[model samples]
Target: MNDKENDSLPVSALQHFIFCPRQCTLIHIEQEWSENVLTARGRLEHDRADSGYREFRRGKRQISGLYIQSEKLKIHGRIDVLELEEINPKGQSNLPSFHLKGTWRVYPVEFKHGQPKENDCDRVQLCAQVLCIEEMLGVEIKQASLFYRRIRRREDVLINQELKDLTRNAIKNLHALFQNRTTPPPINDKRCRACSLKDICMPKRMSVKSVKYRQSLFQPQEPL
Candidate 1:
């Protein structure tokens, strides 16, 4: 076992951290959660992956709900789907694969309840999965996909250096946050409306109180 495996956090926490650090802290640290319509819909969308099935077709192998972890990244989670395509070894005689007959390339797919977001949270989450698989199998994956149930489409994502760097940074930040064991102050922005933990977090009230505290610091001290 790798040294960091014992300290690993969940891969899903990367998405939560990227979306909002405070939200991530509330759930992963404070152990608080609430179910909203959006979250419930997402759970339903992932029902298919909960079965943990494997299938082979058209020279490709597919596995759903495969558990994966990366000691290097210090994260662990279950992948929604993993597709493997067979390829000739060619000049590369030392490629890692399933070890039955042929060399294979990995392609991970993450399922989402909604369409593509304007942020890289989903992409980072998918990339973390790829990193886990690469470490586990010793194969390099250069691309992955996201399946959006709402749009009914699969969007291809390049596992480029930028995305990998972003994913690693997020993982590092997550570990730091976990070590600190502190929930950050909330911004109470538009994103809060759709967040399931809004009521529990009370971002509006918290932000207002924070502002008043700062204002009081600058208030006149005539009576003093």
Candidate 2:
């Protein structure tokens, strides 16, 4: 995709893409959405995180709802929380290099409704945010975090090369998916049961029914 088009993609879509490409296409490409109990709780969790609040406590500066983007990755989104830990400028440590004048440890924390998953969905999302922050601030972040509402605590994530590679691959696939503009067929698996868009998506029905005919029926065509 071109730079202009890539700029329009959101970082959150990477999580969706990781979870299920069809879900990503439905929400991003088709603009379809629905609310379920799970999604509602997740929204409630994000509401507090996205409040645009800032604070300083115990030698750390906490910034909520910080907007960030990456020209290289071609994704933009708001961070749930950006915690900056003050450090000794001259002290040498294993932390990432601080590009800015001040010495600080940067941490991007993402808020989620559930506990940590086995898949890379949440981690990739967090890593994408890290990449965006790195590009925007010209700094390297060695660690990030995720706050799960279910566990009511924070989990540390190592920003390693593997996670970065996964995130970059996901971004490339996301742009390609958007360029194709074709919604993928649903898998009708356990994930479909939890998805909020299950009703609208009709995964089971669509999987069994004639997708092309349904598309032709719903879409308008020009008269010849």
Candidate 3:
């Protein structure tokens, strides 16, 4: 059920699972990575804040490059941004009074250099973060947001029961893929253009071949 040297999985596992399990295992588990220009740009952007805390802004608190851990979920990862519900409106760093309010929030904001995606990969990744927070805080998180730098907008995501189910399934699937060590076939399209691992992923060639194979099987054996 677990690897002997198993480290806790990253919260981004959902993102990888949605993209391609092979890509996720390759990037995270094996720690193998290559830098394309897009990747490089992303790294440079993160370096701007992933190191330490910044001064509080606009009576609200902000933190960048946070490393969070959840014992229950057995997940760990870096959060790009965390909007701590400012305990003090007057600039003091007091934690929220759970005794009075009964609930508090740790709003996660993932920073992406690109625009919003057509699919739920990013949504799942962001949701994964919320799940980790829930496991850590022992509270039901209702929602979170992802901020796209290119578009300069915050897209809110609801943490409904449906997303929770999908996230759990993704984690199970991810562990299974690692054990099997099989890279799924590629799914070609415009998405390939944005994926830095496209060359290693072979999504386009694999998907084209898949379609061809299916067609041949249905062509009636060319009259034998």
Candidate 4:
């Protein structure tokens, strides 16, 4: 498919891709989903952030449920919260916004139900938001934030070269997977235990069966 078609990819797929490719395919490709405690809590968290409101505090403007897109990245999604801060314009003009004036820096903030994970999934997701904002606003975003409900604090993320590269690569992979319409095989790992699709995926059973099949292929036949 052409880049234009791939541009319709969802930004959330990046997080799913990072979490587990199999899970990504199951949901996006197979259209399968099941809600568990964790997912329910996460939905609640997003609902609160997706209320669609704007507030001003401490010289900063906070907007919730901001829809953003990046045709360059071929991804589109709504940001949970976007914080804008006025800054000195470095001899460059900015596009006019109904809510923003002068030179303002954009900072995307994502809300989560739990504390940070061991991987960069959350960070990459936030970075994808930043990329969208940059593309839409024609501004450079150096950082963003992720708010964890359990911790009740925002973890700042730097939009460095490494993160940008990772986010781009993830978008590429997501497009490829979606275009091919292939659902990857299940991987029975620790993350699967928490996955809501565990029952439907049957990763453990499938893994065992695959192992037995491989072993059977290698086994020698006796006199029949």
Best by TM-score: 1
**1-224: candidate 4 lDDT, tens digit per residue:** 87575558788888998999889988887889999999999998798689998898765788999888888878989999988876754423364764445677778899998999999889988998999998888888898889899889988888999999998998888888888876676779899989999998889876857867866888997969
State the TM-score for model 4.
Answer: 0.87
Cα deviation of 78, candidate 4, in Å = 0.6
lDDT of each: 0.87, 0.87, 0.71, 0.85
TM-score for candidate 3, residues paired by index: 0.76
Poorly placed runs, candidate 4 (over 4 Å): 1-7, 89-95, 208-224
TM-score of 2: 0.86
What is the full ranking by lDDT, best candidate first? 1, 2, 4, 3
Q: Backbone clashes in each candidate structure, one number apiece?
A: 0, 0, 0, 1
Residue lDDT tens for model 2, 1-224: 67575466899899999999999999988899999999988898788789998887875878899999887777899999998887865665423542334467888999999999988899999999999998887779999999888989898999999999988998999989988988988878898888999988899888835676777888879988
Off by over 4 Å in 1: 1-6, 89-97, 208-224
> What stretches of model 3 exceed 4 Å from their correct place?
1-7, 29-31, 57-59, 87-104, 204-224
lDDT of 2 at 36: 94
What lDDT tens digits, residue by residue, belong to model 1 across residues 11-96? 98889999999999999889999999999999987988867888988768889998899877778999999987767544353334
User: Candidate 2: lDDT over CA atoms?
Assistant: 0.87
What CA root-mean-square deviation does each model show from the true structure?
A: 3.7, 4.6, 6.0, 4.1
Say which prediction, candidate 2 or candidate 3, comes out ahead on lDDT. Answer: 2
